[model samples]
Target chain A: ANDDCSKMLLNRCSGCIAVRKSLNSRNISKLLHSCPHRCDHHKIIVEAEDKYKSEVRKSFICNKKILLTPRRRQLRIES
Target chain B: MFRGQRGWFCGSVGQDLRQLWVAEGGTVCDVQAADFLFSCDASHPDTLRIYQSLDYIEDNATVFHAYYLYAVANAEMKTSVALGHFILPPASVQKEIRRKVGGFIWEQDKYFQIEKHDEL
Candidate 1:
């Protein structure tokens, strides 16, 4: 939604995209430690973790200045 | 057969696939002088000495996989672009050019065109 904070926002700062990796790892660990009597929660945890990671990666790339640099092969010729 | 003093054999296919084809040689001459060209079958060796010489020439020459056929001589001269060579599949395999797999089809060429471009 438009309400989502843009990482590269010039005036209103949200957070650094690079820090999401550690944030995600911390989240998964917290979820695992809080699980008391495990039932079908394993599948739910795995699905949630995958979704979180995908979102983190997508936003990280989007908020950055650029992704991949453009390049072409050099042509060498002789007479 | 090529008769010009400055000659070049080029493989027009992609660099990744050019290695599979044999080299060709020949000669070209025209009153335009600049239009004069020569070519030979570089892939077919005339003699042991000539075969080695052709290989040495091709190895030393710069190869280009241009949209159109391109030629360069001695590494320092200007490169020339031309459409002299023609590569195509043979008539026998024309029917088998493309085959149906599970849900996909594949095409293969039977004939290869190998030609040399003369100095411009």
Candidate 2:
């Protein structure tokens, strides 16, 4: 339960685990919440990146059907 | 690869060939309906994807762009694997998806077609 040990544990975990694994953030927060550490900055950055990526992912989601019925191609004749 | 319970019909668990629902899960590895889906396992990494004329999204300038746009956007939500090869971003593969969704078949093949489950 030393300060350095707490920091080491936080370093090994990913921010996504907070929700995916349902781990409480209280302890990790105290160790990292607004603390002047690079992991704190990294967590913020990674979280923001995922949010943006999810948005773009929605933009391409297949909600509409794109069934293409083929048409014979006509050769173009120019004078 | 875990699948959530789907009432007692779609398939049976165990050695039986169970179908996967490509939309419900984020990854394609565990979904049903393998016919409508295909992905390269770690070995054959050089596979390709397509968008059939039957499944092509139309250009924007057309009067039907609004309708056509609505269609592709409304298609079923399959795992990214089903699309990364077909509807993928060009940086991953320099070709346009529409031109290649169904190969160059002029109308004989079943071709690629994405539709809403409601339509089925």
Candidate 3:
């Protein structure tokens, strides 16, 4: 998988392809390996990962139920 | 006339533009080495910065956005069809492209005006 990733990077694969491949991988350490240079493809994958993490954080925050029942009720009611 | 020019294309339109560039005798090359950089979206920060630095008349390097190319091609096609000329001369095509670029610059100024208005 690391060899495949290196080959794809060398071929200058499109951002979408790179993002898909990176997202499909179960292990980041293995996929990223020791890439010599931070090329455009790597930058795209990093950006996508950051975006995904942020989105998950946001959703978790939104779903959190605090003890402020009245405030939470009002917020839900308003929406 | 792109007889000896080196060109590079960005975005999906690059493939189409590559064919056109080759047809016009231009060689496709790496972006850094290209005399002509054609992009579908010139609004990308890096491309925008390069475009802002270019002197359209004085600089040998030129960046052509896809909108300008479409406008030029559309006008050329219409003119050729109306005149029953299957193909227009290279000199005439060059002159038309220059005129279209001038118009495109004006359109870009209008875009800036709209952006400023939105900010205000």
Candidate 4:
């Protein structure tokens, strides 16, 4: 029984990670509401959401097009 | 099961996990020579592309995402996969590690506990 419980826990962990990956880029709200797992693992979902938001912010800040727009305008004015 | 295994740690959190892996009797090596690739940021384009490319992944190598371990530490969930792959540790061992680690990525007690709600 102990072994069985352990296996179950392992499977749950595996499933949770799979769910997290699947929902990686999707809406965090969807993960909270529509996730099939229906498991009480909101903490994981929240962390994923936080990570996603930070990544998006980082990418936006690093985007070359956005960063170069002012430089390009300056070059045009100089020309 | 990790004994004698050659593992590679990628990303910031990878270093901590690498330390733990070494403590577990695992050897640290280069990515190409590793049996286990522990990646923290699987969402990165290069990491994602490499994971998506079946040919890039070695036949015998297993990729474990750091998020999975973090989840496990938080008692959230578990796995190994294209994105979700994980190395399974026995529940008792996992619990012990969790207790020792006390929050994998972030500091313990920093995360606010939300009330359990069936509806989100």
Contacts from the true interface found in each model, as a fraction, amount to 0.00, 0.00, 0.00, 0.05
Off by over 4 Å in 1: A1-39, A65-79, B1-120
What digit string (tens of lDDT, one per residue) describes model 2 on residues B3-43? 33221111111111122332333122221211122221111
lDDT of 1 by residue, A43-73 (tens): 3323343343344446546777334233232
- Residue B73, candidate 1: C-alpha displacement in angstroms: 86
Question: What TM-score does each of the candidates earn?
Answer: 0.15, 0.17, 0.30, 0.34
How far off is residue B37 in model 2, in Å?
A: 18
DockQ (C-alpha based) per candidate is 0.01, 0.02, 0.01, 0.04
lDDT of each: 0.24, 0.24, 0.37, 0.40
Q: Model 2, which residues run further than 4 Å from truth?
A: A1-42, A61-79, B1-120
Mind giving the per-residue lDDT tens digits that candidate 4 earns over B1-120? Answer: 246666566553444555556665768766555555666454544344434332221122334554443443344332232133243222333344445432232222232222222221
Deviation of model 1 at A11, angstroms: 48
Candidate 3 Cα misplacement greater than 4 A, ranges: A1-79, B45-61, B67-120
**Fraction of true A-B contacts recovered by candidate 1:** 0.00
**Candidate 2: tens digits of C-alpha lDDT, residues A1-79:** 2443334334533431232211111122222233343443234433332343344334445544422234333222321
lDDT of candidate 1 over B1-120, digit per residue (tens): 112322222322243222221121322222112111111222322211222222112221111122212232211322221221111111222223222111000111111233443323
Task: Please name the candidate that would achieve the greatest lDDT relative to the true structure.
Answer: 4
